[model samples]
Target: MSLLSTQHTLQAYYLGLFGRAADPDGLNYWLSQLESGTLALDDALMLMANSDEFSERLQLPADDDWLAQVYPAYFGRPVDAEGGGYWSSLAAQGVSAPVLLQSIMASATGADREALDATTSIARFYSQQVSPERYDPAQTLIQEGLRSNEALYAELAAMDEQFDALTVMEVGESLEGRPLYSASVGSGPRKLMIVTQQHGDEPTGTEAAMLLLEWLSGDSPEAQWLRSEISLTVMPRVNPDGFERWVQLASGEASPDTTIDPRRNSADIDLNRTWDSSETLDLALIPEALAVRQEIARFQPDLILDYHNQNNYINAAGELETISILWPTNDLIDDQVTATAQQAAVALAQGVAEFDYGFLSLFPGGDTPQIARNGLAIDGVPTLLIEQRGLEEMELIAYEGLAVNYNALSSALILEGLMSMIGVITELGSGGLTDIDPALALQIPDRGERIQYQDIYTLSDERIDKEGMPTETELQPEVVGVSAAVLDDALAA
Candidate 1:
């Protein structure tokens, strides 16, 4: 095969095994490996198949079920009983997944090869078109694995040292003695506090928050402009103890030493539910919530963006929601504060909607005063809830939908959300955030229906047809400045 053929084959492997288009640097490195005879084609394929990205992206059991799931992805059909038995026997005989994948791909007949070719074409298009600035290699690295508590701390420290505009501070400590760190950048009077990973399992926000910090702290014209307009603060990971537990469980390294419920703190308290203004920060247990509350009181931000991820859900258009937003819905919240949050919601929806991949929805949340969105608003601090599509949920959704393109989708979703957030922050800093009509948030379609993991693909078409399409007017907010396109250019600049 020529170099082009070699590249195409590798790109297909990237999409097949990693669920993403190969980055230019990685592609070049592997090409060199092949050209220099450092690794043969089969060896290269197995190396990629054995990678952490492959394992994490698939998360499939290394057994008959793995074959069952993977066969349909490449061949566009379920594994027949005979094939399953054969694969299972091989698996039992200690044939590694990498070897099995190689064997399976090698065994593909005409139609299977054609289906794979089509998928490879999709990867090629994306790889060719993906914006280097938008889909940075650093962003990809962040998504590869969950960062350890110490690693997160070190990264923030390094950012603080590297960027003159960025500062890192230890605000408090987690119940498990992990430092509760907060990063701050920019110096404008209009303050915005971003809190993410409040739910341990919801991690896209943490990744996006770091990327946002990297962007904001750089010397780009937009970053400089925004810095002159808004003092930004971010608590990237709020529930460190819970996130630690979650990471352990996810990596199959569950320790007998820690709590099992990653959604809660070491004290087994739902940190989100602990955010009641009526209760003192030190009341009862879970110092993570207290640390957040303390930071909020100290920052006294004009707006707060709480980021999270929700279970799989389809919007009114019958498309999977890329992200959902909700403002303070508690009756106790001041009307003006709630209205401001509504305006922010409109800004966020408008920002994300500019990207064709994103489907905005009004996250279905109750008006309980304990959750951060409601509780913070009750205290007269405007807060908006942003729930991105859950990572684990999307993995299962993609499997059910037979979508081998999920890694690309997942990467786009995070990058888009991060850019949208940056745009929203720009608007907030420039006072353009409140210029949008708050009532437009009401028009943002409701999160249409919950799609259970096992049946999302099966019912997707039916739901889409029955639910009808979202009107063009839905969430069409009249904004003043800082649109997603403008921000996209700014980010690249």
Candidate 2:
């Protein structure tokens, strides 16, 4: 066929696969072949079943009869002795028609300018439809209540109350000399330190920390109680340079001309992996990670939860064998932590389900430990890595829709988990004791349940009996009530 004819034919094939006949003559020719037993129905079906769009429309039972009638002539009859059918003989390997079309369009005879333009247009269109639009990572922190470092520090400084008299420390500077801020809240015996934005891309946790800080500074009863109970030190933006780089990449304005480049700030080092090695850290003195290390040394937290987005399955830290509370030494802590993580997973799954979203489980050998989860666990600070489903390109664009729901659900889970720890500490500390047996700490059920994407779907399905804990509403009545009261009090305070 001529080049133009080939292109037209391919386009018609794609349209047919999508259940649309682009050229009536071409479609009728294929249909006539099937009727005459020249073109086997199975072969025609194979040609038509190349795209997700095609699979979606093939309403199985509804189209089964039509498919049965048309599939046999295109291909020879099935060789099975037990009444083998054409439906069972359909080709398994199907090409993605849209991708194929784009490739074909790119290689077609055209000027360089035209080709590049077509390719860029196609890519951008696909990305816009399928990828997440980028935003300032700090926006998530702000939504979570931290605001910017400057804003948070200024807010803290303005409040002259004794509770707000804690020291504000500027540990290190970003590449742009934006000072990293850490505020020491309270003088409690057990110090808890949280550092956010280890990966510039994962901004959800950073935002959550900021929101928690804002809540603490406000006049809510829970905030007041939390402040009195624990000395919380939070470093909001550990990687400002990386975050700025991410923002610039997302906006497509990193250079004089607009384009996207995924790199660790200007130096291009993965900040999460920079720890424990001088060579890596020296090549790129990630001010964020360095500053966070200083803060960690200054105020050692009993527990830590460093957040990141795992594009694959959702998982917490630790192996399945070590995930229970029945083990010795760290078992009680493990149990409580695991229960908390599981409960959070359930809450997150449910929250996403309300919006018809789902996520996969962080199976043992997947992408969790090789990243940051293993690093934190090895460092002796019990940490759990929370993952949100979807890619950066997908989630970041739909961020606004997903953020509030995720943030609220995550905040509640973290708070509940932390409170479980706090309750243990409070009981131990009230008797004028410095420490309690880790074994003696009662295990909180539902701490670290691995709620996979499949589980979320199963629960959300109309037919299945939902497993795991009750909804977030049942788990956090007090927090929910206080959140409502906080809003009312914010207007009144």
Number of colliding residue pairs in each model: 0, 33
Q: Tell me the lDDT of candidate 1.
A: 0.67
Extract clashing residue pairs from model 1. Answer: none
Q: What tens-digit string does per-residue lDDT give for candidate 2 at 454-490?
A: 2332122222112321232222212111222322232
Q: Can you write out model 1's per-residue Cα lDDT over 1-493, one digit (the tens) per residue? A: 0112566678667755664557756777898999999998778988887788877766533566677756644544567798889878887788776677767767664335544543444344334444454443221211223356766787788889999999999998888788988899988988889998887767677767777887788776778888999998999889888777655543334543444577677777788897787876555477778788888888899899998887778766655676888999888889999998898887787666545454788888999988999998998999999988765543332122222223333344556567558657867876756678888889988887887644543223321221232222321112111122234354444
Candidate 1: stretches off by over 4 Å: 1-142, 255-258, 280-284, 391-410, 457-488, 491-493
TM-score of 1: 0.66
Off by over 4 Å in 2: 1-166, 255-263, 277-284, 312-372, 394-493
Query: Which candidate wins on lDDT?
Result: 1
Top candidate on TM-score is 1
The TM-score that candidate 2 achieves is: 0.43
